[model samples]
Target: MRFPSLVSGEFVKRINRFVCVVRIKDKEHFAYLRNTGRLSELLKEGTCVYLKEKDKGKYSYELLLAEGEKGILVCLDSQIAPKLYAEGLPAGELVYEPKVVGGKLDLLVGKELIEVKSVNLVRDGIALFPDAPTQRGSRHIDLLIKAYPKYTPKMVFVIQREDAYAFSPNREMDPIFANKLKVFKSLGHRVVAYNCKVSLEEIKLKEEVEVLWR
Candidate 1:
């Protein structure tokens, strides 16, 4: 899972509405950014970045894919999907056969296939997920277990570390996500959540981040 289009060594500005950011070097005084979700990480007020040249655009800039670990996170996602197929535990398998629990799942990972989600709301000491109600998200955990007969299913919630020192679901915002997590655990397939590391040199994101259940 290599990074598709990447920008290296540029000054980053705010990324409102999923914009791309880059530096023009000798000619301009402003940052260059594009409009695409492909750019990893939410563009913030002052994102550090560089540039990857592409065919000319109207704005003369290519999207700045997150470098370092963000790039790795993209790679990890594609790689893990297949690796899970190969090193599957009883609970994990690469069901190339593919199952459509409802009408939404992209891949059914083992017994508890999950839909990947990125969370982006954080402030003060709290982090919020979905930022909107997710009908599919709630259904995903439910289907994970429904797809299985013997064991519980799992939902992998991956988040990047921001300002907070700890992590938990934004129960107040998406109470259903939290409630469903509890239900899943009661059924057996516990909801697993983990954070990706972000920095200047590397970004390794994971649908699964190992941690203590307690």
Candidate 2:
């Protein structure tokens, strides 16, 4: 998806999960961070980042993109996955945040219940998800598992960078979530991962990558 006009900045420090300090043109400013993941790999001191100015808020700018290894632009907005997924479908074929089976799923394309996850951490050409422990993500998998054959369950991992050639669950960070994914796949559910072509102007869904579940 296309982004608003972005300003280049240098990441200074993270004040909290939702706020970070960035230097734009030698002036430090507090920016809103939409992703709660522990982005230790990307958000380092003096790292180059892109931000969108906010009209009226506690923070003047919102963090949108960050430069990863080898100058790859990684999307930091976690909420963009469903929007990117919806963009690939025909009009009226995709539903956003639909309530199903007692819980809300990311998107519903026909009978398919899709749960989209944003991934930013890439190591050794492999993208891993849930940079931190995510009980909420595990719960989403459980909801998909519960839906079962009644509704086709799909777990889509969107790697918001172009460097990753494969995707895998961070088993060391959240084994429960990894195990739940295994169970879901064992039940004949679908698990897919796709890498994106991210730039300062926009981020688009690229080709599907190998899902390395081990």
lDDT: which candidate is best?
A: 2
- lDDT for model 1, please: 0.46
lDDT of 1 at 182: 69
Tell me the spans in candidate 2 whose CA falls farther than 4 Å from its real position: none
Per-residue lDDT of model 2, residues 1-214, tens digit only:
8899999999999999999999999999999999999999899999999999999988889999999888999999999998898788775778889898899989988888899999999999999988999999999999998887788999999999999999999999999999999988888899999999998899999999999988
Clashes of each: 17, 0
Candidate 1 residue-pair clash tally: 17
Estimate the TM-score for candidate 1.
Answer: 0.55
Could you give candidate 1's per-residue lDDT for residues 1-214 as a string of tens digits? Answer: 2334554444455455434444555343333443322333444434445444546644544433333323332111222332232233343454543556554454455444555455434445343455556666677767666766733355655554433333456576578876776677777665555554544334444334332222
Over 4 Å off, model 1 = 1-5, 8-97, 109-112, 121-128, 150-152, 161-165, 199-202, 205-214
Q: Lowest summed-lDDT stretch of 10 residues in model 1?
A: 73-82
- Point out the worst 10-residue segment of candidate 2 by lDDT: 85-94
Go through the candidates in order and give each one's C-alpha lDDT: 0.46, 0.93
Distance from true position, residue 72, model 2, in Å?
0.6
lDDT, candidate 2, at 7: 97
| Candidate number with greatest TM-score | 2
